[model samples]
Target: MTYLLICCRLLLGVVFLVAVTGKLRGPAAFTAFVSSVRRMRVLPAALARPAATAVVAAEATIVAAAAVPVHAAGVLAFATAAALLTALTAGIVTSLARGGQEPCRCFGTADTPLGARHVARNAALAAVAGTGLLAGLLAAPTGAGPLAAPVDPALAAVAAAGGAVAGALIVMLDDIVALARPHR
Candidate 1:
């Protein structure tokens, strides 16, 4: 159970942080992505920019808040993830119903367009968030007692850097893979 919570924390943290980084790095690209989806009628033109900005900002905020002590942070992280999942699920369902096909920028950019698979992935994350929230409520502690202690400062720094790198890679893997594909 404790291990599961830790996994959720790491996965959600890395995922959101990476997402925010990709979006932040390519704001124009993301805007273009959002606008393209809007044109496809997945989102309204009037709501595109604001919605895009809000989603990115919310992700950033979640990752940032989740970095702190577990009590409040866990709650915040859960809420943020739930909100994201709800939005993504609704968008995916609506688009599918309309026979719309648009890329999901949830992970920033992707080789494939948004579809039921992406929605399922988000739904899984939502489940993780729910589990974490429940765990936090039941167990007043963030991580297991001693094993979770901070490591040496240097090692901690290295780990943080690695997490960031891995997060970025994970978020961009689809786009990177797409670029590697042979042009038809």
Candidate 2:
């Protein structure tokens, strides 16, 4: 169970790190993200820049907090993740409901257009965060997850590989869904 929590932390941390890096990779990417936010219409055009900054800052904080192996940090990371995911889901829903057609600049560029899959992905991420928080809260004193020192190298390696795979799948969801669609 401790190892599971650590893996969750790793997976969640990697997800945020990737998002932050992809979104901020260059001026063009950031500009694309701002444009997507404006298309969503969740916030006023005047507020898009500050909102983008806030979003990136929040993601960075989640990555940093997730890297800490303390029980409290895990809880904080999960809580923040869940909240962030909820807001993202809402934005997606709003865009879809309003018939806004634009690519989701979620992982990187706006190559992949927004769809129900994006909403599903966000919901899945929120679920992961909720589960992580519950695990932290249920953990015993002195901690058993990442806080339980002396993690085996082999175990850690396996966990890391798993986290990497999970993160890859999430970031590639657009492609995955596209591939799964039936062709004429």
Choose the strongest candidate by lDDT: 2
Q: What shift in Å separates residue 178 of candidate 2 from its native position after superposition? A: 2.7
User: Which pairs of residues collide in model 2?
Assistant: none
Candidate 1 lowest-lDDT run of ten: 142-151
Question: Which regions of candidate 2 fall more than 4 Å away from where they truly are?
Answer: 143-146, 149-153, 182-184
lDDT of 1 by residue, 84-155 (tens): 878867878888788877766666555477766667677877887888778766766545544243345565
Model number with the top TM-score: 2
Task: Output candidate 2 Cα RMSD.
Answer: 2.2
lDDT of 2 at 119: 90
lDDT over C-alpha atoms for residue 82 of model 2: 92
- Worst-scoring 10-residue span by lDDT in model 2: 140-149
Q: In candidate 1, which residue ranges exceed 4 Å CA deviation? A: 40-42, 141-184
Q: lDDT per residue, candidate 2, 21-72, as tens digits?
A: 9999999998888888887888898988888888888899889999886778
